[model samples]
Structure formats: C-alpha cells, structure tokens
Target: MRDKLLMAYRSIRERRTRSILTVLGIAVGIAAIVSLMSVGYGMEEAITGELTGYADFIGVFPAKITGTTYVELGSFTDRDLKDVQRIGGIKEFSAMTFDSAEVEYRNKRVPIFFISGDTKELESMYVEPVGLKEGRWLRENDYKGCVIGDRVANDYFDEVVHVNDKLIINGEKFIVVGVFEKASTLYASDIDPYIFLTLRATKEALQTDEINYIMVRVYDIEEAEEIAEEIKEAINDNHGLDDFANAMTMGSMIEMMGDVFNIIRGVLVGIAAIALVVASIGIMNTMLMSVMERTHEIGVMKAIGAKSSDVLSLFLLESSMVSLVGGVVGCVLGAVAAKVISLGAGTALGIEFGAVVKPEVLLGGMVVAMVVGVLAGFYPARKASRMSPVEAVRHE
Candidate 1:
C-alpha cells in the first residue's frame, strides 16, 4: 500500500502544471466570493460606525423611512415642523432644507450644493458643529449669512473668503459667515450641499416652506432605534400614513446590516459548494486516469499477495495527499487574490475595506477545499481496489 501510494504521488508530481492549473481555477472562484462579501461587510460596518458617532441623530420623512436619503415631493408646512416638536420622548429636534446653486465671487464662480434651514433647539443633536475656519459659526436670527465649505474657500473664493465676503447665489446675495473644516463621511444626511443656512432664508430663496427633512434627537440615545420604532407606530396611527415606516436608528441599521451580511455569507458558501464540487470532479478524473494507466502495475502487486484492502488504502492515501496539497495551494492563492482586490481596488475606488483575508473566511475556504479533495478521490480509489489481477494483467 505504501509503495503504491508513493508511486501515485510521484506520477501526479510529474504533471505539476495540470494539477496546478486545476487548483488555480478553483481558487479563482472561491476568492471572488470571499473577497466581495468581506468588503461589503466591512463597508457596512464603517458607515455604521460613522453614523453612531453622532450623539442623537435621527431623520424623519413624510413618505419614506428615516435614515434614507430620498426626498419625496411635499412641502413641510411650518405647522408640520411645529407639530413634530410637540411629540413625546423627543429631547430636541431641528428642521433642514436643501438646494443647489452657483456661488460667484469677484471674478470666479463655483457650484455648491447647500443645506438651508432654520436655527432651532437641536443643533447639537443634528450636527456635530464643524470647526469654523473663518469668522464664526451661525448665530441666532442670522439671515443672509452662509457657511462655505473649505474646498469652496480655497478654489472659488480666492485665498481668503472672510466673514464679510459677498457670495452671489442664483443672483441673490449672501454674506459668508464662516467656513467649515473639510467635510468627512458622505453618510451624514440628505443635505450634501456646500453651504448651510437658516430654514427661513432657504424658504425665501428656494421659494418653499417645505424643509427637505427633519431630525429628532431622542431622550435616551441608546433607545433611539426602539423609540424610532415607536414613533413609526404612532405616526401610522395618527396620520393614517402606511409604508412611511422608514425611520432608522444608527444601532438598528448596524444590526440590520449584520443580518444582511449573514444572508450574503450563506450565498457565498453556496457558491463555494458548487466550486468545490467542480474541483472534486477534477480530482476524481485525475485519480481514475492514474488507476487506468497503473492497472498492470496494480495486477503485479495483487499477484504478489497484495490484499484488496491494501490496494484500496494505498489509492485513497494517494488521492488524499494530492487533495491536501491542492487545498493548501488554493488557500494561499485565494488569500492573495482577496488581499489584492481589497487593497488595490479598495483604495482606488475609495471604498476602504480595512483589510482582506478575514479569519472566518480563510478558515472556511481551507476546510471546503480539503473536503472537496477527499470526496473527489473516493470513487476512483474504490475502483482501483476491486480490479481483477488476471484481467488487468491481460488487458495491456
């Protein structure tokens, strides 16, 4: 048995190119599934963490759920904002509006997407209060005053866009009150414009009383998600609004992303199953070909008193060793591919998955590869064991 197994190993090693190609093919499929899922999960986590850093951020939309960036067609009557302020369990809240316009300075013009809204009770809850680069932060009852993005400052408004600098917007004039430190994380809210202003001013300039959205800071920050659920039920009961249940808490979103990743993991595992099956078939074919070509040698061993069980064990051992080597090679290749994708594409695309080869994914891939190798060897090993010595010797 030992001699036969060693012979099988030697024969496969002699054809290293074919064996390596088969393993590489299987590795390619496994790596793709593993890498894509890992990155997706990572991105979701990063965004969730960014969301949670806010003290008590919550968003409310009339037709859509909260935490969504979609803006539906509706005017947020001043009355609606007042009614929301009266809701129970609400520590504080703010109303915000949005618009896009071209900002023109003395000789240059640049487009800026800006959020215009009123100053209200909940500045801390809704915004993290950006660092003021120029004059000062927004003041109470400050109108015709706007904050510029730092990027806007350097490029459009010359070297210094000071507090008193005039900004032309859609031919309307606004005094630059302050500049924000560079913005971070696009996941903040629906308002992604280059300027921030009072809600009343936004209404007057944009010609709409409707705010783009509203944010509510819950009394207990930890219960934000739970309270958001409660808020949904209450709104449904009172407003007779159905499917307007899009309120989301940062914690709840993280939890929901977790569930989604689990489902995605299951799908990736399913794809791995198919790939393993294919690789297993290749191993089986290699083993059977080895059996056919070595039949005469097998017959010689049997005639020399090699038992059928001995013959079977030897063939099985040969295939197992071959599979084991394939598994190791596949694991290395898959990890490399995953890392390359995570670092190369991750950085280039700015998706920023921390690192590639997640421990769970690596362990799972190795286990699947070994199982595929063993299963592929089984039937061919059995066939080699049952051959008749006399017939095999006479055949060729």
Candidate 2:
C-alpha cells in the first residue's frame, strides 16, 4: 500500500505542470459549485427577511382567481376585510388597495406601486418601515398626510414638498407629511417602490371600494392558521358576497416562502453544478491518459507478483489523491469568489449578504471528487490489469 502511494505520488510529481493544470481545472468547477450555492442561500435569506418584515401584515392575494392569468388576477373587496374581522378570536384587521400609479409633484412625476392602509396597522405592523431619513411617519386622522419610502421621497418628491406640502397622484392631491427610512425587501431584498395612502382616500381616487390585500392580526400568533381557515369559511357563507376574498395568517405566508426560497437556492446551485460536471470529465480524461502512458510499467509491476487488484488500487489511489487535493483548492477559491460576487451584487441590492460555504456543501464536494476519481480510474485500472507481461515488454 505504501509503495503504491509512493509510486502514485512520484508519477504526479514528475509531470508537475500537467498535474497542476488538471487539478486546477477541477478546482474551478468545485469553487463554482461551493461559492454559487452559498451566495444563493444568502440571497434566499435576505429575501425572506425583507418579505416578512411586517410581522403582523399577512399578505392577502386574491385566492386562486378562477380561470385567470397571473396578470389578470382580481382585487379583494372591503367586505372581505369586514368578513375576516367578524370571525371569533380575530382581534384587528386592515385593508390595502394597490395600483400602479404616477405621483406628480410640481413638474416631476414618478411611478410607484400605489399602496393604501387605514388605521395604525401601517406602523403597528411595521409596514411603515423602520428608518426615516427625514420628517415623521403617517399619523392617524392626519387624513391628508402620507409617507413615502426613502428612495421615492428623495429622488422625486423632495424638490417640491418639504414637510407639509401636497403631491398629486393621478391628479388627486395628497399631502407629503412623512418620509420612511431606507428599506429593502425583507423577503426578496429586491428594491420595489411602495407608496402608501389612507384606504378611504385611495379608494376614492381609484373610484372603487376594492382592496388588493387585507392584513389580519389575531389573538395568539398560534391561532393564525385556524383563524385564517375560519375566515375563509365565513367568506364562503357571506350572502352578500359577489366574489369571496382569500384570508391568510402569517404562518401560511412564511411557509410559502420556505418552499419558494428552496426552489430558488436549488436553481442557483444547479447552474454551478454543470461546471462541476465538466471538471469531472477532465479528471476522467487525465486518468485515462495516465493509464495509457504507464502501460509498460503496469505490465512489469503485474509480472513481479503484483495482483490485478494491486494494479487497480495503485491507479485508483493516484486519481483519488489528485481529486482530493483539487477539491480542497476548489473549495477555498469558490468561497472567495462567492464573497466577491456577494459584495458586488448584494450591496447594489441593499442587502448585506455574507458568503459562507456551508459545511455540508464542502463535505459533499470532497466526497463527490473522491468518488469521481475512483470511478474514472475503473476502466483504465482494469485495462492495465489484463495486459500480458511479454506482450507489454516487447511492444515498446
């Protein structure tokens, strides 16, 4: 065993540049798999945080709108909010109406997702955002006062409105009272412009009583799902209902995020996986070439009381050593690359995502490399074992 290892080591050392190149090729692939996966996982984390920031604001998408495209989904009704609040054990709830809108401040016009919420749920649910670069947040009964996110307020409205001025949304004037601090998507970390208003005012502006989402908070966080179910049933039974609204507790939304993020992480990892497969191909090629070059040596070793199994073990050991070393190099390189990618993209996205190669990914890479080495060496090892000593020695 020692002799085989020594021989394997010597062979690789003799062809220093070739061995290094071969290992490096595999390292590049390994690094990609490890680093990209880590980054993907980090992105998923960032997005989850961004989406769930409003702990109490349960998203209320129109429940499986019958026979409609994602683009054609209908809005929820105000009665839907009333129905949900009517359920027993349900404490408080609020509704939001959203539309793509253009806000005009003097000569400047900016487009954003027009979102409106009534009551203190905007702040109480943390939907108002935590940080404000300037001014205060939306106050109840300050009917005309509205708050805009940092990006929207500064870049667009700041020029016209100071603290107590009005801006126009679809020709309807609204007072710019407060500005929110910089906020990222706690769920996606993707920047989106969300402009808020009073539900009543927003409904009037849109010329309808329709709401796009309803946020519900129940007694005891654990009862969120049960309360949501009861709400759903109540909506179905409501006699005056035209199209029923969908109710969701926070738990269901969070659970949906888990499945969603897992798929995203898997996709990112899969892209990197293709690169690793190419590296494995390179490993296999190198092993086959090594076998061909050492035909005479293999024959001589076999003639000198070395069994076919010994010949197989020697080549397998060589491939394993090469891949093992390459795997380590790849892991380190990949982690550094992930960090660089994270810093460049994550920062731009306003997310402080850190690149961390999970232990499982690292270990998995090593195990895969070793297995690939052994598998790649199989045919060559068998070929070396079957050669006749006389035929090999006389050939070259």
Candidate 3:
C-alpha cells in the first residue's frame, strides 16, 4: 500500500501544473455545493426557530363572502366568540382588533398600528411572556396603559418615547407601560412599529364591539389540526355557512414552509451538480492525456514483473489524491464564502442570517470528490494497463 501511494505521489509531483489545475476544477464544484446548501439550511433554521412559539397555536380569520363585492366577512360578534370559547381542547384564547391610528407624544405625532387584545391571553398564546426591551407589559386593571413596539419608541418620531410617557391615540390619552422587542420573520420587517392596548380600551376608541380575529392555544400540539377543524365547524354552524370562518394551525403552515425549502434546496444542489460534472470531465481528460504522454514508461513497467493491477492502482491512487486535496480546500473556501455572503445580505436587509455548515454536508462533499476521482480515472487507467509492452515501446 505504501509503495503504491508513493508511486502515485511521485506521478502527481512530476505533473504539478496539470494536477493543480485539475484539483481546482473539483474544488470549484465542491465549494459551490457547500456554500449554497449552507445558506438554504441557515434560512430554514432561522424561520423555523422564529415560528416555534406558534407550533401549538391556531389562528382564526373571518371567512370571505362569495356574493357581495362591498361587504365580506363580518367582524366577530359576541355570539361567535361565545361559541368558539365552548370548543373542546382550547386551553386559552384571545381576541384581536387592529386599526391604523396616529399617536401623539408631547407635541410630536406619529402614525402607527394599534392592536387590541386581552392582556393575559396575549401573553399565554405567545407561550413566553412578552419580551421587553424596556418597561413592562400591560396589566388587566391598567385600562389607560399602553405598550409601544421597539420601532415606535426608537424610530417613529424625532424624539424617542420612554416608559411612563403620556400619549394620546384618537383623542384618548394613555401612558406608555412597556416596549416589545423586535419580532423576526423571513419575508417581512420586524414587528416593532406598533402599539398594543387592552381590549376594552381599543373597543371604546374604535366604537366597535366586534373582534377581528381570535388567537387560540390548544392543549396539545399533536391535536392542533383536529382542534382547528372543530373550531372551523363550530364557527361555520353558528354563521350558517361552511366558509363563514377559517381556522389554521401553525404546524401545518410550518410543514408547508418545509416543503418550499426542500424544493429550493433540491434546485440549488442541482445547479452545483452541473459544476461537479464539468470537474469530472476535466479529471477524465487529464488522466487520459497522462496515459498517452507516458505510453513508453507504462510499457517499461509491463516489460518488467509489474502486473496490470499495479499500473491501474498507481493511476487511480494519483487521481484520488488530487480529488482529496481539492475537497479539503473547497470545504474551507465554501465555509468562508457562506459567512461573508450571510453577513453582507443580513446587514443590507436588516435581518439575522447565520450560515449553517452541517457535519453531514462536509462529509458528503469529500465522499463525492473521492467517488468522482475513481470513476473519472477508470477508463484511462484501463487503457494504461492494457498496453502491449513491445507495441508501446515501438510506437514512441
């Protein structure tokens, strides 16, 4: 084994320029696979992580009206809420109403979103208590209190708002109680430029007794789909239409997102495979050229006691060694490329992206390189082993 490897090493050393170029060809393919796949993996991880809180939660949206052009799904009535509350498997739930309004702090006015909900139920649906950048969350008894999002406090106005500051919304004055941390999502900006108020306060200000949507937390995540169906049926029966309301579970949404990423990963890997095919062809051509150039040397070896197997092993080993080096260099380059690209893109988009370099991905790149080497070298190695000693010597 040592002798075979030594022979291979010497052969490669004698053709340094050709060997280096061949290695670069393989390296380019492997690097592309590693870098592109890493980015896909990273995006999947980021989105999935952000959605963890919604794993067991269900969303209820009003159904669209079929016949009416100006009027569609009406707001949730008192009866609708009462019916949904009676559904089994519901651990907790909260109603939400949203409106666009201008908030005045001192003499400065800024337009912002107003989300109204039950304070405690809001905390329960998110699983974890609201994460605060400063101050505290709203309390049930604090009807005059409000919580602003991170962007509202820092970015919405000329002066930054702080806890305990007084603000007027639609002629109603309230005190700022807390600020929520920025929320992350894949295709959307952070959820940090809004205001949160209690259900009663929002209702009084909006002059509406209807709820826009309901956020439901189920007892078990595994039963989320079943619970959603039950909720849909219950709401539809109350409204006398199957499409009066729609229920969606977070788990199903996550699975759909997983399918999207799977397709993306396959397409990206396919593109990388093209580069690998080109590299494989380069290896085959280089090996065949080496055989033609060393025809007489092969004949001399065959004229002696060296068997055809020995000559085949020598050539195969040389090709494998070149691929191995390329694979290692490619792994390093790919990882660096992923990091640099992630950083640049993350900054420009105001999003967090981390390049994921999984162990299996690295190992797969090496295995592919090695397999490509053997396959690429096989025909050329066979030609060298089959050379007749007298004919090869006479030809050159």
lDDT: which candidate is best?
Answer: 3
Residues 1-396 of candidate 3: C-alpha lDDT, one tens digit per residue: 998898888989899999999999999999999988898888888777667766878988785533223234877778888888998889988888866787888788877887778888765533143377778888877778888877888887778889998888877899998877665445334447778888877777656556778889999998999989888888888888878787778777677678888999999999999999999999999999999999999999988867999889889998899899889988888888888877777776667878898989989999999999999999999999999988877767
Best prediction by TM-score: 2
Candidate 1 residue pairs in backbone clash = 65-246, 66-246, 66-247, 76-210, 113-193, 113-194, 114-193, 117-198, 117-199, 118-199
RMSD of each: 4.6, 3.1, 4.6
Tens-digit per-residue lDDT, 1-396, candidate 1? 567767767867777776676566556555655666565556566566666676475666665643435646454556556666766678867777655778888867878887765554333433463455567666656768887766677655666676788888777899988776654443542222367777666667656565656777888887787767765665555555665434666566667666776777678767766776777787788878878988987888788998988888787777677666666666676666666765776566434455445777767766666666667777887888889999877767
Backbone clashes for every candidate come to 10, 10, 0
Q: Please give the range of 10 consecutive residues that has the lowest summed lDDT in model 3.
A: 63-72
Error of 3 at 67 (Å): 24
TM-scores for all candidates: the values are 0.76, 0.88, 0.79
1-396: candidate 2 lDDT, tens digit per residue: 788789999998987888898789778878878888788776766655655554454455565543223332466555656767777765677777667777888778887776677657766644444555557766656556677765666666557345666777777778777766656544422223566677666666656566667777666676767777776666655534533546655565666767776787788768767877787777778878877788878778777888878888888888888888988998888888888998988668775667666899889877777776677667777777777877765555
Mark the regions of model 2 whose C-alpha exceeds 4 Å error after superposition: 49-57, 63-78, 127-129, 154-165, 188-192, 203-208, 239-243
Candidate scoring better on TM-score of 1 and 2: 2
After superposition, the stretches of candidate 3 with alpha carbons farther than 4 Å from their true spots are: 49-54, 63-74, 98-112, 124-130, 141-145, 164-175, 183-189, 208-210, 302-310, 332-356, 382-396
Q: List lDDT for all candidates, in order.
A: 0.67, 0.70, 0.82
Evaluated at residue 356, the lDDT of candidate 2 is: 64
